[model samples]
Target: MITLHHCPQTRSMRTLWLLNELGVPFQLRTYPFDRTLRSPAFLNLSPAGRVPALEIDGARMFETGAITEYLCERFSPDGLGTRPGSPNRMQWLVWVHFSETLSQHTAALTQQHVALREDHMRSPIVMKLEAARLGKCYAALEARLATPDENREYLLSSGFSAADISVGQAVYMSRHFATLDDFPATADWYARITARDSFAASLPNDDGIYDRDFYAPWPLE
Candidate 1:
């Protein structure tokens, strides 16, 4: 059985969601984010002291992007892991890179988190820049989703793919971007994913860490 070293309501949740989507039975070796990242055992699992590391057949893996690809490749071959020469294989390749590259938006959300923390050193000057940068990113995302009229619900190709997973999580997580009502396509895309029974089973819906308040960097603002 695979063992996923995860923390609640984090990037680690993606791995859990993937596993759940694939109907794979696995162990969730959960640890608290509070000081757990630095623990010797945890560091052995992930040198970066981050969540979402996975142990499969005794091999350890880190990074949500890599882990998501690896899990999909190993378990969901019919879904995300097409061979390199195949035409659809490009989808996985595109999303693996797209997910990582688009992390700028998520970082903006993170900056909001740090800024709002009572002890964090967040200056209004920094927030102004981040808010501006995030605006640009959101606009780009808006344009990217404008393809395929108002009916389709994905970033690329039909139905859901790793692309949707990457973008869905990012957009759902980017609360500060404001009024998802403006991006109906992306909003509709995510609603479908969130409604998936697989997603509901895997996601930590009860975890306060993933709560709206947690993503809000309001106090500092």
Candidate 2:
């Protein structure tokens, strides 16, 4: 059986949503977004003390992108993944991995706005810079989705794949730090992909982090 060590609203949720879409039976072990990740037992599962540790086929795995590629190749290669030599393979790989580029900025913003609980502990410059970076990522998505030839409803011309799940989940985290207002196409694409039942099922039951819907960059004081 597959076991997913997940922390809601984190990169792990990308794995969770993909698993749901795969329709494979798996056990989920939820963890708090705290120092519990650094505990000895948990560290054994994921040496880096980060979430999305997985147990499958008697082996352990971490890293959301690697896990996504592995699971899709093993379980849904023709559907959620584009196999090598396939027409959309290169683009698939690009967008799937690009999600991390977006998430890193969101992670930084989260650190500034949410993790650093006190105003004095946060840096307005970092918050603004990270949030601006997220906007740039949004622009990239907007351009991709607005491809002139195809009415690209998804990230790839082929159709929806793990790339959508990967980036969509990242955008979910990013929404707290940056609004989608400026990128109309990206906003529409985000709405379309997230309307999937699998995406809906992956939402956190209780707050995992960021108590507010939005975290504006801390204004200089």
Candidate 3:
């Protein structure tokens, strides 16, 4: 059986969402978003001590994108993945991995807003800059979803796939730092995809890294 080591409201949630959509029976091992990841036992699962360490077929895997590709290819290639030689293959790969681009900025903002305990420990500039960068990522999604000739409800032309799950979850994290107000298409797409039962199943039942729904940028002096 597959096992996923996860933390709520982190990149690992992306993997959880994918697993839910795949409908595979798997065990979930959740941990707090803290130094527990540094424990030797956890480190053995993920050398870098990340939340999304996967145990499958007696092998270990890290990196959200790699795990997404492997799982989809192995279990639901046609449903959640666009295999090689398929028409949407290139676009599929692009959007599936592009989630990291958005997530990197969210990780930065998370560190600034959630990870730092004291106000003095946080950098206002970093908060503002990372939040702005998340807006830029939102803008990119807005453009993609607003394609003139297409009614693009999902990321791919073919239909919903892991690419949506990947990027949608990134947007979920990004929303705390940046609002989707200006990006109408992105907001709509986000709402549409997140409405899925699979997305709902992936959500945390308890408190997560962020205490609030939104984390506004620190005000300048």
Candidate 4:
């Protein structure tokens, strides 16, 4: 089985959530959120020094966006991918990339404004500038969700897909530093995803940690 080396409350959790959703068998290697990223083992795995690095079949991969895309292409069940020649495939492809481009950067910028200690955060003027970018991203999502479609439940496809999972996880991260009130439709989309049977199985504790063995308490799907 593939092994995911990760630390809690970090981007690694998103990959964990994706694995759970797919009901794939894998091993989990947990690490603390400190200098472990600088260790020789981790450094050799990911020179960028980040958690959520993945090891599979003797090969290593880094970056949540890249990892998720590769997993979906290589491991997902049939019909779960943005297959070639499918008209909606391009749409899904764009949304998959947009999951990070449209949401994560803005969210992380806002984190600097609100999450850091008083002495650590930058000036209020900088915070306002970051907040503006975040607002624009939220506006795009709200428009999509509100644009009216009889079949508007999922972000793409007739049912759930990896694209939805990517977008959902990104939206879920926004809560750490911003309010969903500003992004009601996006908030509802993420809430609906977490309520899934698969997501409930992978839900982390208040400390934002998920024990792999915890899933073993009951047979995996």
Candidate 5:
């Protein structure tokens, strides 16, 4: 059986959401977003000591993007994934991986707002800049969704796929740092995709990495 090592609100949720959408029976090992991930046993699962370490077919896998590609290709190639030569393959690959772009900035903002225990340890400038970067990411999604002549209910023209889950999970983390109010198309798309039962299933049952729904930028601009 496939086993997924996950943290509630981190990138691991991307894999979890995909797993839910794939409809495959698998074991989920949930961990707190803390030092337990650095334990020797966990490190053996993921050399880098990160969430989303996967054990499948007796092999261990690290890296969210790699895991995502492997799972989609293995379990849902034509559904949650696009196989080679498929019409939406290129777009599928583009949007699927683009989630990392947004996630990177979210990581920075998270470090500034959540990871740092003392106020003096955080950088307001970094918070503002990273949050702004998330806005740019949101704008990119807005433009893609509002592409001329085509009405996109999801990222790919084909329909909902893992790409939505990938990016949507990133957006889920990002929303705490940045709001989607300005990007109407992206906002609408986020709302539509997040309404899915799969997305709902992937949510944290209790507290997650963040203690609150939103964290305002430092200095309160």
Candidate 6:
């Protein structure tokens, strides 16, 4: 049986969403987003002590992107995955990995807003810059979704795939820090993809890193 070591609202949710979409049976081991991840047992599962450590086929795997590719190729090559030689394969890989680009900024903002305990510990400059960076990421998605030649309801012209699940979850985490109102196309696409039952299933039940739905930029401008 496949086992996913996850923390709610982290990159692990990406895998969880994918698994739900795949409709495959698996075990979920959840941990709080804290020092427990640094324990010796957890470190052995993920050397970096990250939330997305996956155990499959009697071996452990870390890194969200690697786990995504492996799971798609193993179980859903023609469905959630675009196999080699398929026309959409390149686009598939690009968008699938592009989630990390968006996620990196969210990670920074999460550190600034949620990780830092005291107000003085958070830097306004960092908060402003990271929020701006998320806007840039949203702009890129807006451009892609609103291409002149085609109207893409999802990231890929082919249809919904793991790419949407990956980026959509990133957007899920990002929305807490940045609103999608400015980029209409991206917002619509986000709404379309997030409406999926799979995405719904992956949502945080009770515990999460953020205490509130939205965390405004520091200093209130």
Candidate 3 all-Cα RMSD: 1.3
Lowest lDDT sum, 10 consecutive residues, model 5, at: 212-221
How would you encode candidate 2's per-residue C-alpha lDDT over 120-172 as one tens digit per residue? 89888888889899988998998999888889899988889999999999999
Predict model 3's lDDT versus the native: 0.92
Evaluated against the true structure, the overall lDDT of model 4 is: 0.67
Clashing residue pairs in candidate 2 are: none
Residue 6 of model 6, lDDT score: 95
Decoy 5 TM-score against native: 0.97
TM-score of each: 0.82, 0.98, 0.97, 0.82, 0.97, 0.98
For model 4, how does the per-residue alpha-carbon lDDT over 1-221 read when each residue is reduced to its tens digit?
Answer: 68998776677777887888777789998877668889897999889888689999999999887888788888773445666676767767777677776455644554554355353345555555555565676777777666576446666745677777777666555554345677777777777777887666555555553222221111121
Off by over 4 Å in 5: none
Q: How far is 1's C-alpha from truth in model 6 (Å)?
A: 0.8
Q: What is the model-wide C-alpha lDDT for candidate 6?
A: 0.93
- After superposing all C-alphas onto the true structure, candidate 6 shows an RMSD in angstroms of 1.1
Which tens-of-lDDT digit does each residue in 141-201 have in candidate 5?
A: 9999999899989999989998999999999999999999999999999999999999999
**Sliding window of 10 residues with minimal summed lDDT for model 1:** 210-219
Candidate 5, after superposition: displacement of residue 82 in Å?
0.4
Which residue pairs collide, candidate 6?
none
Instruction: Kindly give the stretch of ten consecutive residues in candidate 6 with the minimal lDDT sum.
Output: 212-221
Q: Which stretches of model 6 miss by more than 4 angstroms?
A: none
Q: What C-alpha lDDT values do all the predictions have?
A: 0.65, 0.92, 0.92, 0.67, 0.92, 0.93
Runs in model 1 lying further than 4 Å from the true structure: 102-104, 111-116, 148-151, 176-179, 210-221
Which portions of model 2 show Cα errors greater than 4 Å? none
| lDDT digits (tens) for residues 1-221 of candidate 3 | 89999999889999999999999999999999889999999999999989799999899999999999999999999989988999999999999999999999999988888777788898988898899999888889999999999999999998999999999999999988899999999989999999999999999887588778888897622
Error of 4 at 165 (Å): 1.3
